[model samples]
Target: MHVARHKWRSSKTAQRGVEELNAQVARHEGRVQIVNPEGLHPLATRPTLREYISQLWARRFFITADARAKALRTTRDYRLWQLWLVLNPLFDVALYGFLFGMLLKTSRGIENFIGFLFIGIIFMSMMTGLMNSGISLMQSSRSMIRAFQFPRASIPFSTTLRSMIDNVLPAIVALLAAFLFQWGTWPSWTLILVVPLFILIHIFGCGLMLITARLTAQIPEAKTILGLVSRGLFFLSGVMFSIDRFAEHSAVHQVMSANPCYIFLTAVRDASIYRTAPSLATWGELVAWSVGAFVLGFIFFWRAEDKYVRLV
Candidate 1:
């Protein structure tokens, strides 16, 4: 009985020692002290920018998993499930190919008009999809945003990721349709250039997501008009025809040609359908737009992080 009592005392002593060590480590770890409590932030308060980035890095897996889950459920409501991803592009190709290629005859001066139209329509849809989804992101993730305390940027980032996943089949189909309809030859090295073009375009899309997500949180009604904005961008993006269609209006032609959306689609078409190297200018614009937009958008969105939580 005496030995048992001694062992119990030893165990208690060891437990106290461990707790004391933990306290010391906590102190060294910058544990905040509650002196007045008024200055204390909630446990999940917004971290500093550097810390916020690190948090995002640490949560990369969670972001990808969230994206995967969202991607899977994206088409659940549709009767055809994932086939919509493939069919949607085909439908767009057919409708536009008929309207612009047949009626408007915008396909007149272009080589391999069918392939060009397919690549342009499918690629531009990815961009418009990102903008539309980002504009509605806060509303769609309202419940999760309120219940959790993660970096709000993760929503847009995950959305960008989800877009990448969902666009895979469509992107592949675009290239295949190009080959099947017009560019009938063995794949060339220039075709591989589409890969980088794809990545940069999606990076640009992520930036669009960040910008629109913040805008949406600020002006909830902005969501309604954002779709129209995307459609406007789509039409101006040279999706179904070349910018030469605006040749009579030099001013409109210049603006449309200079548009980053036009540049991106033209780059993919040049690389994939035309099998020609995209100009250094095309690559430069893509890099600048993708990198610049992402950096600027991150700062803009981070500035409004606190506002997202309160958005209804």
Candidate 2:
């Protein structure tokens, strides 16, 4: 009887141990309850839109500094250094002027054709630079991404900022060329509008860069495709010719006129060349494009922020 009792006790102890082990395993399988001041969050996932923007804002200083650094780095090693900034645009203007003005005679009807062409080339350069930089933005920042924890949007934003800075010398040269070529008149109060218009363009470029950066990150091959597409856009953007030439084709005219490059070039020409404030319609369009693209691109990029690291 005593032996039987001992066996029964052993069995009960073993059963109790098994039950304890199962309880522990079940508790571990339940949802993780992380406790911290920053709140519980997954490391390998994207933040909400609101949170992402907030994080980006927090790093604004970094963006500006990085942009300036990049701008300096790019020109530092060049043979002509900063001179290329002005000379490059001048060369492009001369080339396009020959093609469209001399060969095609597209500039025959336009008043101050030189000024119009200058503004178009300089402004379009900004757009092209933004798109091109965006394609390599993620790849360029792979090292930074691995080392730091910051918004990926900052890379594209910094790129746009660098482009804007690089254009300062070119813009001055273009303006001077326009005036010398009789494309622009003396500065007036209307010229002040260039400041605001440029700000809008910068915003628009930032948004576009964001979208392209995300796209290239997701699909590596998109870089080559985007380069070709951007070249085609240069022709369609009315950089070398007036959109009015297409006035008879309502569909084509509307498409080209609605292009952000065309809108920005027109605004610059109106302010500097025509000595007039951009019309309310133009202002509305610029604002709409800038705000819409920025919001949409930010959200789109932030949606895949976590994935960027994996892509590299």
Candidate 3:
């Protein structure tokens, strides 16, 4: 019994010594110079906002690429059209032909409603796709949230990028269909600038994605509410009909004017059908919204990132 007591005391003493050594090392760390090329590991306890951002930027590409590729493969398989590059938009155009052309009969004056609806539906769907997929981003990637320690901001970005790829086929089909139908002549050569315009739209989509991802990640119930909101936005954004015809209604005009969806859709419509640039005022609003969305969402989401693994 005496020998056991001695061994236990010795073990306790060693443990106490180790604790003291650790405390001393922690104190000395304040003066010690680190030659770390890869930087120190971030503590979950107190992460500076800037340091968190730096870590995100550092791993942005890999996370973005992996997430994007995963989303694309999933979409491709679900659609079951390996040649989805050709089929997706063609299908959209046909569906619109039936809905808007035959059912609504709203394309009367527009030589070929098929072409007009094709352009509008395809472009409008891009925004809808972003909005739709974005709301589900966090929920869809719950496993990734637990498995990886990268930035949550990358999640929305990857989702938006994936949606943009899906938009490509529809965009191409719209252009070709427009030309074949002569619904609107091929846009001005200046329309080539539309590429960057769509890019801005994508950035805006990213911001919306972040906003939605953060909200839905926290409250899964929000997913259904957002779906309803997106459906309303779909009609409001002039997907099926032109908002220009509603100019006489002051209230509707005002609401449409303030809608970011309207601004973006008009920007795309002007570039493709009217061959003009997005209005400066609308561009300014979009830029402001995009930057604000990203910054706000990043900070909000980052706060919960460490807890995500635990929650999942």
Candidate 4:
């Protein structure tokens, strides 16, 4: 009987010890437990804003490489190659010139109407391309997004970069056409301003792209709505004729004068075609629109980075 009681007591103590160990484990507050090997890791969590920016900076080379590759691929099918870049803008200018300059006689008040039309068409194309890139940025990049672990913002950045590079040849061709046809004079010192002006326009475009990218990602239907809205903006932008023609109507004049598109195009024409410095007001408006949009769009997009993978 004594031997049996001793063995039972020993077994009870062992059971009590096991319970205490479990209680200790349950009560433990700061211990680092091993995660399951197959479970999601902490690295999968969303990064901070500063970290996101750093990642984007680190991937700048990827942006450039991707932009170049896409640009080449886009033109590879065309036999004319880069000639299309020059010809497309020229054809657009001719069409608008005939419609607005000939049919409507809208060139009466404007000097060098062809040059004016050229500047407007080329710049508008750049703007429209940038915005479209942003709107379609996510949809087009789904495969990359799913296959890679890079900054999603890079997609839109690369898209904008590609658009800028593509526009370079078109811009050169348009300028040459302006000078060759006596639509505008030869280049001058004022033309140096084109660099800074284009940079500002690009910055403004980046902001717009960010905003549209985020919106389209959330609501795919927004793309169609934005397309219609952009069409309306084209008319308001004075791409075919001078907005100043409506100056007699004070309200219409004020609206068009205040338009960001009109402001940018006018500035370009002033520098490139007229060989004159853009007004202080034009500079101010451009800076205001570009900087404001960039700041707002960047913050808005950055806040939603984590949601993109899931949303897409």
Candidate order by decreasing lDDT: 1, 2, 4, 3
Clashes of 4: 0
Model 3 C-alpha lDDT per residue in residues 100-198, reported as the tens digit of each score: 767887676664456667777777777767777767667777887767667666767667767777676667778677667764376686567668767
List the RMSD of every prediction in angstroms.
Answer: 13.8, 12.0, 9.9, 12.9
Best by lDDT: 1
Better of 3 and 4 by TM-score: 4
TM-score of 1: 0.84
Winner on TM-score (1 vs 3): 1
Pitting candidate 2 against candidate 3, the one with the higher lDDT is 2
lDDT of 2 at 302: 86
Q: Where does model 1 exceed 4 Å of error?
A: 1-39, 42-45
Supply the global lDDT for candidate 3: 0.71
- Candidate 2, residues 174-236, lDDT tens digits: the string is 777877777335877888898888788888888888888989988989989999988988888
Ranking of models by TM-score? 1, 2, 4, 3
Cα-based RMSD of candidate 4: 12.9
Ten-residue segment with the worst summed lDDT in candidate 1? 180-189
TM-score of 2: 0.83
Clashes by residue pair, model 2: none
Tell me each candidate's TM-score: 0.84, 0.83, 0.76, 0.83
Per-residue alpha-carbon lDDT of candidate 4 for residues 61-153, written as tens digits (9 for 90 to 100): 999998888773556579997677677888999998999899999888787788888888888878776777777678777787777787788
